[model samples]
Target: MTVKTTLSFTDRHHRFLTDKVGQGVFASQSAAVAAALEQMIRDEEERELTLGAMADEIRARLDTPRADYVPGENAFATARARLQAAREA
Candidate 1:
């Protein structure tokens, strides 16, 4: 399969990519970019999945109220102190 597009690259990056391709590391500049873009897409998909899982966890936390909050202590400081204490223990 073959694809073509008018893609732009900065001078420095262009030189760098071209050099790698010229060294026989890649069959062509397009091949190098396509390989990089394929990896980027895979990474982005993984990131999106991880973020979605985190968002779900956050929503669950929001629905569950903690009974440990002490009066007069700000939420952040209390949470940080509890977490640090747990880590030290």
Candidate 2:
């Protein structure tokens, strides 16, 4: 089911939508708006997921004992060398 509602856009945004529809990117203004909104939703969800993962990593690192951890300099160099090897492969 779809709900119909009125939305207002600035002149520039309206023109951009109109041009996209005219160029056959979308069949109508509604389609263009829907596509834009869907992409925005996807992007925001991805951002939230990324931030959540980063928080989990930080928490895990903080919980680890200092004795169990490697030095930052050695860890960074090892990671960089691995990445370079992967790219070359």
Candidate 3:
């Protein structure tokens, strides 16, 4: 299903689309625009999936028992000691 509508583009954008069409990169301006839109949709979907995964990870981390986790100060001191050792080596 295709909907016909008028679209406005800057001169630069028009030239880009025209050049792509001339180079056989796309069948027409509409095809180029559709491809761009499809890419945007994919990017948005990927972003949503990444955010959901990050949220799930945060939730899992929050559910961990406090006693089972290292204190932040201890963690930082250990990291600093490792860094100093690496620098000296």
Judged by lDDT, which candidate is best? 3
Taken over the whole model, the C-alpha lDDT of each candidate is 0.88, 0.95, 0.97
**Residue 43 miss distance in model 1 (angstroms):** 2.1
Worst 10 residues of 2 by lDDT: 70-79
* RMSD to true structure for each model, in Å: 5.1, 3.6, 2.5
TM-score of each: 0.64, 0.79, 0.79
Superposed Cα deviation of residue 7, candidate 1 (Å) = 2.4
Residue 31 Cα positional deviation in candidate 3, in Å, after optimal superposition = 0.3
Name the runs in model 2 displaced over 4 angstroms: 78-89
Alpha-carbon runs more than 4 Å astray in model 3: 71-89
Could you give candidate 1's per-residue lDDT for residues 1-89 as a string of tens digits?
A: 67668989999989989999989999988889989999999999999999999999999878776675345557478789999999999
lDDT of 2 by residue, 1-89 (tens): 89999999999999999999999999999999899899999999999999999999999989999899988788799779999999999
Ranking the candidates on lDDT from highest down gives 3, 2, 1
Best by TM-score: 3
lDDT of 2 at 45: 100
- Which candidate, 1 or 3, has the higher TM-score? 3
lDDT of 3: 0.97
Query: What lDDT is obtained when candidate 2 is compared to the true structure?
Result: 0.95
